[model samples]
Target: MKISKQLNKLKNLNVEAEKCSTREEAKKIINKANKAQSKINK
Candidate 1:
């Protein structure tokens, strides 16, 4: 359940990041997502 929930959250984040018009904005979103994902791994 937790893994599925995290995957769903990541999917939503990717969708939202794709909507970003600028590279900087997309990078920020990706970095934030990576940080959150790393925490889960730890």
Candidate 2:
């Protein structure tokens, strides 16, 4: 949570990539998100 909060300090960072219009793109985003969450949970 603290690491994520610090990342929020970056003004250009886009945490919510909600503009995915393709299935492939969406899958890539979902996979990346899961990977990140797993790392944080560990």
Candidate 3:
């Protein structure tokens, strides 16, 4: 349940990433999400 919830959150982040004006902007958003996810995992 937790994993699925986390995945859903990431999916939402992906949608937001697509809205980013530039590739670099998207990467920054995704990278922040990844860091947040890693912290959650730990």
Model 2 lDDT on a 0 to 1 scale: 0.55
Model 3 residue-pair collision total:
0
Candidate 1 local lDDT, 1-42, one digit each (tens) = 466666777888899887999999988889878976875676
Decreasing lDDT order of the candidates: 1, 3, 2
Per-candidate TM equals 0.63, 0.60, 0.55
Q: Which is the better candidate, 1 or 2, if ranked by lDDT?
A: 1
Error of 1 at 31 (Å): 1.0
> In model 1, which regions exceed 4 Å deviation?
1-8
Candidate 2: which stretches are off by over 4 Å? Answer: 5-16
The Cα error of candidate 3 at residue 41, in Å, is: 5.1
lDDT by residue (1-42, candidate 2, tens digit) is 565743343222234456667788767766666655565666
Candidate 3, 1-42: lDDT as tens digits: 467677777878888887889988988888978966985686
Q: What ranking of all candidate models by TM-score puts the best one first? A: 1, 2, 3
lDDT of 1 at 8: 74
Residue 20 lDDT in model 3?
89
Backbone clash pairs in model 2 (N, Cα, C under 3 Å; residues 3+ apart or in different chains), count:
0
Scored by TM-score, the top model is 1
